[model samples]
Target: MAAKWQVVREMDANLIDTALVEAAYANPALRALFPLVSHGSLQFSRCTRFPWSQDLPSIFPYDGERHFRVRRLHEPRGSGREQIGGAVTADEAVELVASHLPPGCGPALDGTPDDLESLS
Candidate 1:
């Protein structure tokens, strides 16, 4: 069975939402990984349905400016949560989200070749 896992971190809600949307638009695969995106006054979430379980994979970003907490919701028998990483910028938060995607879900890049190359 797939390991029930979650990646959590904290960052600006708006920043995370925009990053998730932009990433999905840039990479169609991510659309499958994160089909639903929602935002509230205090938090933002991106979620996708999984075949193994009824509960979908969820990514949540808590409100903050320089430093924030983000959490990945997992259903390991029951509702569970984990902290995977944190970020100082929206880009970093997005990278963390991409890196922690459930098994089988591949990497996601939201920048041009030059931009990606520079990071390498």
Candidate 2:
């Protein structure tokens, strides 16, 4: 994935989605990850750069019901993803994501993963 990371973000209140906000506060750990929206769904990244890896789970709020859904993004795009579980609240959804986080996963990287690669 050598494409640039282009995320649609509107700081304006009217353009923002409530679900994105809900997912942000779902968990402190989730809050720590870089938040972004993909195809109207809330997704988090472990780094603030392009080509977001499958390091974190993607969460979606069902049809404005405010019900959160946590899913694991699998490789080979369009192969479908795994449904980890569902949550009545953002907190619960993030809790599920938190448990599945990679071992030793910390706050999102401040830079691209490539930045780290160069450091080593």
Candidate 3:
């Protein structure tokens, strides 16, 4: 059986993550991307389906407390994420992420790039 403390810890994480996701969705810009909650981090992607690009940015709770960190995902492993900025609330964090979105990025594509290509 799972330990009680572990279960509680997971529940707490979920609550924090859910709140972050809700805040992200409230923004029209983020409502289109696929949102994911990992531990206390909130990550966004440009595709709703699988095989998401790892180059997108992620929002993490940082500064040893309630502060949020918006960062860019780095590839090739161990390169370290690029810090976008810090926010004190979920709304502020969402705004930071939304403001840094890729140029001309619209609502997330419905599927993989290949799926989009075939439509051309």
Candidate 4:
């Protein structure tokens, strides 16, 4: 089965940078499982594996409201990028991302008791 990944908490847009760093720090084990890259105003958190020639599953902030957006980065080809979903909260965003992640990525942070397993 593919591993699943989810956000541990709701990220505040006012402190997005701090939130991202704190989330990784709070979940050190899962931190290494998914790498986060920030470029200017854009941030990318990848949680899925992909073939050498394909793109991985990633999430970023959209609009000024900091709505969470998911997509696959095709890189140089840049032809396959598509918006997978959008949510008003980080937690919801992760739930949406979880549905598309490959098996074994980790666990879903859907504010459920099972979420605790991922942090353990």
Top model number, TM-score: 3
Q: How many backbone clashes does candidate 2 have?
A: 0
User: How far does residue 28 in candidate 3 sit from its true spot (Å)?
Assistant: 0.3
lDDT (tens digit, per residue) of candidate 3 on 55-84: 567899876466788888566224589888
Q: What TM-score would you give candidate 4 relative to the actual structure?
A: 0.46
Poorly placed runs, candidate 1 (over 4 Å)? 1-16, 27-29, 41-57, 64-68, 106-120
Candidate 1: Cα lDDT at 115: 40
Clashes of each: 9, 0, 0, 10
Q: Which candidate gets the maximum lDDT versus the true structure?
A: 3
Could you give candidate 4's per-residue lDDT for residues 22-105 as a string of tens digits? 443344333434443444122223223331222344567676565667676556337777777765455555545555554554
Over 4 Å off, model 2 = 1-23, 75-79, 115-120
By TM-score, the better pick of 2 and 4 is 2
* Model 4, position 82: C-alpha lDDT score: 76
- Between 3 and 4, whose TM-score is larger? 3
**TM-score, one value per model:** 0.44, 0.67, 0.70, 0.46
lDDT of each: 0.40, 0.63, 0.66, 0.44
Model 3 regions more than 4 Å off: 1-15, 74-79, 113-120
Instruction: For model 1, state the Cα shift of residue 73 in Å.
Output: 2.9
- Tens-place lDDT per residue, model 2, 8-115, is 333443433554555455456766677777655667677777766455777776556667778886752345788888755666676778888877565677787676
